[model samples]
Target chain A: MIDPALGSLGAQIVLAASSDENHPPENIIDGNTETFWMSTGMFPQEFIIRFAESMKIALVTMHCYNVKTLKIEKSISDDATDFEAISEKEFEHTEGHLQTNDIPLNGTTATHLRFIVTSGYDHFVSVHRVSVE
Target chain B: MVKLRSRCLLVGDAAVGKSALSQMFRSDGAHFQKNYSMTAGVELVVKSVNIPETSDSVELYIFDSAGRETFVEACEKLWGQPSVLCLVFDVSSELSFSSCGRWLERVRAHCQGLHIPGVLVGNKSDLSSRREVETSVAQEWAQSQGLQYHETSAKEMENCEAPFLSLAQLFHALYQDRLQTIQNLA
Candidate 1:
C-alpha cells in the first residue's frame, strides 16, 4: 500500500493457498504477511521499483483527491514494463463513481481504487492493492 | 474433520491499534507496530484461551478489518456473520473516537436490524496525558448507546485483557442460553 499524502509505502508477502483444487502451493499471499513501512515522498521511485522486484505478481491501484492527480498514464507506464490499463465500473454503487482505471501486471489485475478524491486546491494518491503472480 | 470456532469481528478507524490489540491478546510477547495500509480486506487470526473457571477451551476467530471509508461496504458484509463486535478507537486521537459512531451506525444498518452486543475500545491509553477524548465523555456516549466501553493501551498492556475476556464471557453466557432454549423446545 502507498499513501502519497502521508508519504508512506508498505509491502506484505504471505503464503496463500492455490486457487487450483488439485494442487496448491506450500504457501501463498492470501492473508498472512509481514508489513513494512517507508516514507512515500522520500523514495517514490525506489518504493515503486522495490515493490515490483520483490513480488512475482503485482497489482497497483492509484488514488488521488482529484482524478487528474492520478497521472494514471504516466504512473502505470513508469512502474511496470508490461502492463495494461482497463476501465471498470463494477464498484460504482460502493465507490460513488461509475468508472475506474484497472492496471494489470505480472498476471494480476488491479481491480479496485479504494479511495479517490478530487478538488481544485490539492490532490492525493493512495494505492490499496498489490498481488504477486 | 477440523471444526472452526465462532468468530468475532473487530471494526474501527485506521491506525487505532486494532491490529496491535489483536496481536497482544492472541500472540505472546507482542510488540507495537503499524504497517496495515488499508487492510486490503479482512484478516483472520485464530487463538484459543481456557476460561478461568471452565474446563473447556474456546477458540476465537478474530477478524481485524480495514478502517478506510472506501472499505465501508466490505466491512458491512463481514459484520453480518459475527457473534460479537469490538469497536476500537484511539484515545489520543479524538477523530478516531468520533468515527466510532459512524462505524456503529453502519454496522447496525448492515446487520439487518439484528442486535449484536458491541464494546467500544478506547486504545492507546499509555498516552493518556496527550489524550484528546476524555474518559467521561466516552463512557457517557457508550451508555447513551447502550454499548459497553473500555480504555486500553496495547503498548503498555493496560486493561488489554479485560475487553477480550469480558467479551469471551458474554459469548459463553449467550451460547449457554441458546442451548437451554433449544433444550426447552426439545
Candidate 2:
C-alpha cells in the first residue's frame, strides 16, 4: 500500500485497506504475482517495518530504476526491518494530533518483499503490487 | 425469514460527486441543494431496496467519508465491516484518477487479510468535452487493480443507479453461495 507518511493519517489509510473485504485469490494477485503501485517520497522507516509484519509478502517498487538503485544503501534495508521490530516505534514517531494503536502481528504466512521501480530520479521507488503464493 | 443488512462505503478525493450521486440515488429525485459541507468524519444513510425475485428487502447502510487527508482516521473506522467499497473520482480530473492507486492501497492496508470487493467510479461524465481522464485509462487501471469501473453523472442522474444495483447483485450472489455452503455442511 502507498503510505505518504508515518503519521496517524498515513497509518489510518493503511488500516483502511487492510479492513475492506476478501476479494478472493484471483483478485489478490493476478495469476501468481501481486502488483503494489506506490509513489516516491519520505516514507517513515518505522511504518514500513510495521507494514511488513502484517503482510504475508510485500514487493516494493522503487519509482526510479537508476536513482533508487544508487540510493539502495544498507541503511534503507535496515530501516525496513527496524520498522517491523516494534509497532510502538511507529506510533511514537507519528505527528502529534494523530492517534495510533499497536496492531498485533498475527504471525501470518505473508512474507514481506521489496522492489524499487523507476518514477524518475532512480532514488525513488514505487511499489507496484504484492502477490501471495 | 429475516432481512439482512449490508454496509457499503463511498471513498475518494474531494469534488468527485460522491455525496451528490448518493443523494440522487437515495432520495429519488428530491433535490437537496446545500453544499453539505464535505462529509466531515463519516456520515451514514440507510435505505432498503427490494429484491424482486424474493419478497425481501435488503437494507443497505452506506457510509460516506470525507476525501480530505485530515479525515483519514475517521474513514479507517469503517474498514473491514464486510461491505462493498465504491472508489469514486472525477472524470475531469487526472490527478483524482491517478490518486486511485494510492486510495486502493490504503484500503488494502487497512482491511488487512480481507478481500474486499471494489468498484471504481468516474463521476461527471455529463461534461464529455472537459473530460481529463480517458475511459480507456480508467478501464485499464481498474483491470490492473481488479475492480469494476463505471463512469456516471449524478447531476444528470445518468447511470447513477447502475453502480449501486450491480453491487447489490454481487452481494446477493455471494450471500447465496455462502448459504449453500452452510446447507451442504448441514
Candidate 3:
C-alpha cells in the first residue's frame, strides 16, 4: 500500500504559520526529494499534516537539511489540537546532501502528525519530504 | 543625480528560469551558469539601472525566490515587504502559467491590499515549438491582473532586461510624480 503521508496519497498540510509564495509548506509531502519546505526563520517552527484517514504508522521517514532538533507528535482527533508526543531526536550535521532519517513510531495510529523544528544547524531548516510506513 | 532603491521580488513556479534571468540581468549578459543549484531559499542580487541620457539611477534588490509550492510559506517570511513584483512563468508549460494566479493572490494577500507595481514575464521563449501559453492569451490575463506582460528567453538572453527595466521606469515615474505634486503644493 502507498504511504498516506505523500501529497499524492491525500496528505494535507492543514496549517503552516509561515508562507513563502515560492516555497509553500506543501513541498514536504509532494513526494519530490528535490522540493522542500523551508522555515523563514526562528526556532519552534511547526507544520501540521493530516492523513487521509486514521492509520497505523510503524515509522515516519523525513528527508531534511540543517535540522538540529526535531520533535514529532501525533493525534487521533480530526482537528489539529490535542497532539501527543511521539518521538524527538537530535540530528547529526551532514554536508553535500540532505540529512535523511527515520523516526520509529512503534506502531502508533494517528490522523494527524506534527513536526516541530526546535533548532537547526543553521538559522533555517528545510523539510524536503516525509513518508509513513 | 538622484539614486533610488527598491526591493523587487522575482517569483514564479520552479524551473521557470527565474535565477537565470536574474543572473543574466545582473551580469549584463556576461554570465549564465550552465548549472544551477535549485535555489533552496531567497537569493539576493543587486543591480543598478541607469536611466538613459540621465545621471539618475535606480538600484534594485532582486529577491529571486524558490518557486516550489512547499517552500513558499517560508519564503514569504524572508520577502519582508517588496516595492515591486516580477512574476514569471514558462511559456512552454501551461501549468506554470496557470500557477501565476495563485502566486499573485498570495503576494497581494501578504501585502494586505496595498497596490504593488508588477509585471508578468513569460520566460523560455526560445522553446517556441513547445509553447503552451500564447502571447495574446498571456497578455490578456496579465492585463486583467493589472500587470504589463513581456516574454523572454534566459538561455539566449533575449529581451531579458525589458521586465526589470520597465519596473525601474515605473518606479522612477512614480517618484517623479510624487515630487511634482509636492512642488506644485508648495
Candidate 4:
C-alpha cells in the first residue's frame, strides 16, 4: 500500500475549477482532514491529480463532505486530457461528521485520477483528503 | 499602491450566518446565498477595502472556517496565525452566543500570545423578536475580551459591512502605528 497523492510522491493537482488562496487544491492531498478545498458555488466541480508515475491502484479513499455524486476517471497519457471512466459512486448524506468512502478500481493502471463532484447535498462541497493504493 | 494585506478569521458555532455575512461583504451586497450548507472546512474569500480619506487600501484575506467542533482541529491547521478575528454568533440562539467564549479561547490559544485585534458579531439581528442574546450582554462580553461588538442581519443585508470594515481600519491603524515606531527609531 502506498499514498500516491503525497507531495513527496510528486502527485500534482493539475486543475481545479475554483481556486481559493487559503484553501487551494493542494489540501486534497495534504494528508490533513482539517484542511480542505471547497467549491466556490456551482455544480460539476472537477479536479485532476497526476501521479509521478503510472501505478496500479486498487482503491481510492476519500474524506469529504456534502458530496452527493462523485465520478472517478483515470488517464495514463502524459497530458491531463483523455481520461477514461473508472468508477462512480453516490455518497450518502452526512451531517456534523465527514463523509468518508472508498472507491475500488480493481488494480487499474493509470498515472492520473480525476474526481468530479457532479452534485452535492449543499451549495458547497469540501474535499478533505484523498489517498490511493 | 500602498496596499496592505491581513488574514481575518471568521469563526463561530454552526449555523451562525458567518458564510452569509462573508458572502454579502465579498459581493458588495450583489449576492446573498440563501441555501444553508454547513461549512465542513474553511472557505477563503478576498476583498479590498479602501480607507475613506486615504488612497491606501487593505486587502482582507478572510478565512471563513467551519463552526462544528468535529472539524475544529482540522480547521486550526488551515488558520495560520490570524491577524484579526471575527467571532460571530446567532442573536436568537443562546447556546450559540455562549459558545463564543470557547471559540475565542480556541483562537486565542492558537495565536500563541499574539495581540490580534478582533470583534464580536451578533448575527441574525433581523430576528429581534426571537432574540436570546441582549445587546448590552454581548457588548459587555466583548469589552471584557477587548473586542469591539457589532450586530448584523445577513438575511436583510443590514450592517454587514461594519465588522469587516472595522477590522480593516483597525489593521491599517496598527500598520500606521508600527511604521511611525520604525520612523521614530530612524
Cα distance off (Å), candidate 3, residue A111 = 62
Tell me the spans in candidate 4 whose CA falls farther than 4 Å from its real position: A1-133
DockQ, all candidates in order: 0.01, 0.01, 0.01, 0.02
Query: Residue A44 in candidate 1 has what lDDT?
Result: 13
lDDT of 1 by residue, B134-163 (tens): 999999998788778899988887777677
The DockQ value obtained for model 1 is 0.01
Candidate 4 chain A vs. true chain A: TM-score? 0.97
lDDT of 3 by residue, A53-115 (tens): 999999999998878888999999988779999899999987667888988998999999999
Q: After superposition, how far is residue A1 of candidate 2 from its true place, in Å?
A: 54
The RMSD (Cα, Å) of candidate 2 is 17.2
Worst 10 residues of 1 chain A by lDDT: A37-46
Per-candidate TM-score against the hidden true structure: 0.54, 0.55, 0.57, 0.59
Q: What is the per-residue lDDT of model 4 for residues B1-186, given as tens digits with 9 covering 90 to 100? A: 345667899999999999999999999887888899889999999999997798767788999999998998999999876778999999999999999999999998866566788999999999989999999999999999999999999999999999999998887777665434322322
Model 2 lDDT at residue A110? 27
lDDT of 3: 0.83
lDDT of 3 at B133: 95
| lDDT of all predictions | 0.52, 0.52, 0.83, 0.85
Task: Tell me which residue pairs clash in candidate 4.
Answer: A34-B74
Model 3, residue B130: C-alpha shift (Å): 0.5
**Predicted model with the maximum lDDT:** 4
